[model samples]
Target chain A: MAHLTYFNGRGRGEVIRMMLAAAKIPFTETFLTERQPFEKLIQDGLLPFKQVPLLKIDDMELVQTGAIVRYVAKKGGMYGADDKEATMIDMYYEASRDFYSKFLPVLFMKTEEQAVKDAKAAGEDKYFPALEKRLKETGSGYLLGTSLTMADVGFLEVLLLCVEFGGDDFLDDHSDVKQYYQRLVATPLMAEFLKSPFRKRKNDEQYIKEVKRVLNRE
Target chain B: MAHLTYFNGRGRGEVIRMMLAAAKIPFTETFLTERQPFEKLIQDGLLPFKQVPLLKIDDMELVQTGAIVRYVAKKGGMYGADDKEATMIDMYYEASRDFYSKFLPVLFMKTEEQAVKDAKAAGEDKYFPALEKRLKETGSGYLLGTSLTMADVGFLEVLLLCVEFGGDDFLDDHSDVKQYYQRLVATPLMAEFLKSPFRKRKNDEQYIKEVKRVLNRE
Candidate 1:
């Protein structure tokens, strides 16, 4: 069985978990509530980059969230069909990452008002229009082909965050993305996994405080 | 031939160019001397994320440096031969990125003293030992298999930056990496490519000031 180590929240780790769920891959978890365990993992030399979420699989421990997620996606046959399609899938995945990178930073640095403003601006100016255009252009309801690839998986994750920070009406303006998001969430695999007992909770004040305290950032 | 658009500096644009050189990919470059051309590209919908280092290939415009670099590596046979190898190659590539992200940020915001300290710490504590360990383990002088892969390419790029920021004796203690770096530099393809007239200069004050002025940052 594959194992994952991280905090008990939907930060970077959740996306990997979601990919596992999408692929129906069984995996275990090590949810560290504090910093000591994380430090110990580094001390034990299990983590090359001294970070999590680390995935232990195929007798190798992988760090770097992007590497881990892509590996899982590749192994699960979600990467794409060929080199060109794979590149496109990677491009879309990276596009979502850029959106999340710009949209979510303010949440850690300042007020909710500012965070919302940043999210809206990032979505409106950068991601929303381009993605809507691509989705409409595809007309297949999926980002690439007729089925769900890591491209859609990554986009769904960001879209969920967008709606959370910007509101449901966030996608209301981008009807194509809204319909695509709905279609992805309605997939039987995703629908069931969203309610799984192992599904982690949303990041909250307590979780943030606990993690920051452990990392000595507080 | 593919087309690349970016500033005439080895900042974010160089690595992609290096991968192209390594794979012997024939591509033309559009070196943006000012911000006007960059904004024009974005305005013309050529840049998806409102950024440069965009590559026009396969009749599609690709953004995101990582995606573009990986695509080139994949096409050039530098991305490992299989999925597992590809994952390791990506892990190594990302490790180098992590090193650069930490090592270079200080140059833009603070003193050279602090930048050196951060670069040394980032290299020694994080990248150095792990990479040395892996290199010795592989015994191939490559990050993955017996031949040059994207992992080695990525590391060589960072090692060049590491030498620039840390100095000649930086890799002295890491004997394996030092020798490997020397071997990569001596390669026939790379040796000739390094002297190409099209190679961009390293980032400097004039380039930075020109970019900022054009972008209205000042």
Candidate 2:
């Protein structure tokens, strides 16, 4: 049995959870709150990188989120079978990484104003347009060749974060990106997941709220 | 025949070049100076991401340095064939990415003091230890299990970058990482490649020199 160790809500662990749910894979969701098992795991070999979202597959433990997601995606048949589609899937996955790399550091900042400013300049100005263009180029609506791969799931998670942290109007300026976000949210599995009780802004809500307040003040 | 497009130096393109040279794969190295064909390519496709180090197979273009490296690694048989080895390879590759994510941004900073401070805090403090731990855990001396894989090559590239940008004394603080770098550099194929005229940091000399200057500044 595969065991996933993460915090209460979906953050780095969301894509893996969603993939498992969609594939009907039975696994233990070990939420590491500030409590018993969490504290124990932190002290033990579980927290190898001293980070959460670690996947325990039987005996082997995997740490990197990308590796874990790809492992799960491969098991779920969400990673494309053909080489071309797989390459395309990889392209989208890396592109999402590129997008996140631009804005992720901002979230670590103490000031909400600085975070919003950085997001606007980097996320809105640079990443969104590039993503929009790539989406259009794909021509199949999906980020990759045709089917919903892990790339789609990864992008959906990022888009969810954008709405939750960057606000409802996060996609207001980029129509294509906004449309893509809407399409993603409307997907049946995604919609259900979004409505599920498990869907909350894990450890990030305070930062999101603070950023929103700063934007209002500005 | 595969075609690699990048500037004259071994910036992101070096590993692919080395892999091809080791495999004796016939590929055209299209150096993009302020030249004609490069200008035509710029006007034609614009590199999808507007980045160098793109690989073109027949008509299709593949972007992203990691993606390109993986694709080439597969072609060169540097990535493992079996599932378990592949997973190990994936782990090392992911670790290399994690290491770079911490240090690459610091290299791009304008101020020398700020760059060194950030590198010390993030690069030396956070990344090096993580890499060292992984190297020790592998127990194979090479990054992955038993045999040398693309992960080792990828990591060697990162370590080489540290030495190039941070100077020879860069990895002096971490004995294991230093040993791993030396071991990688001693590989006959890698050693031969290093002796090649193409291995000189001529094209990227200015960037490296600036980085070294910043790193060495008290």
lDDT of 2 by residue, B1-218 (tens): 88887766665677777666555566787666544555466467656554567788746688777666666666677777655566667766776766655555544445645564555555565456666877778887876666567788777777776776678988898898888889889988788878875464633446555333432432
DockQ of each: 0.72, 0.36
Would you list the clashing residue pairs of candidate 1? none
The number of the candidate with the highest TM-score is 1
lDDT of 1 at A174: 74
DockQ of 2: 0.36
Compared with the true structure, what per-residue lDDT tens digits does model 2 show for residues A1-218? 78887766555677777766555466787665444564466567565445567888847788777777777777777778765666667776776666655455544545656666666666654467667887889877777766678878777777776776778998898889888889878878778777775465545665454333422432
* Model 2 root mean square deviation, Cα atoms: 6.2
| Residue A13, model 1, lDDT | 84
What digit string (tens of lDDT, one per residue) describes model 1 on residues A31-145?
8878788788988988876667889988989888888888988888888888788888888898887777765564454577777777788788878777887777788888787
List per-prediction Cα lDDT, in the order shown: 0.80, 0.68
What DockQ class does candidate 2 belong to?
Answer: acceptable
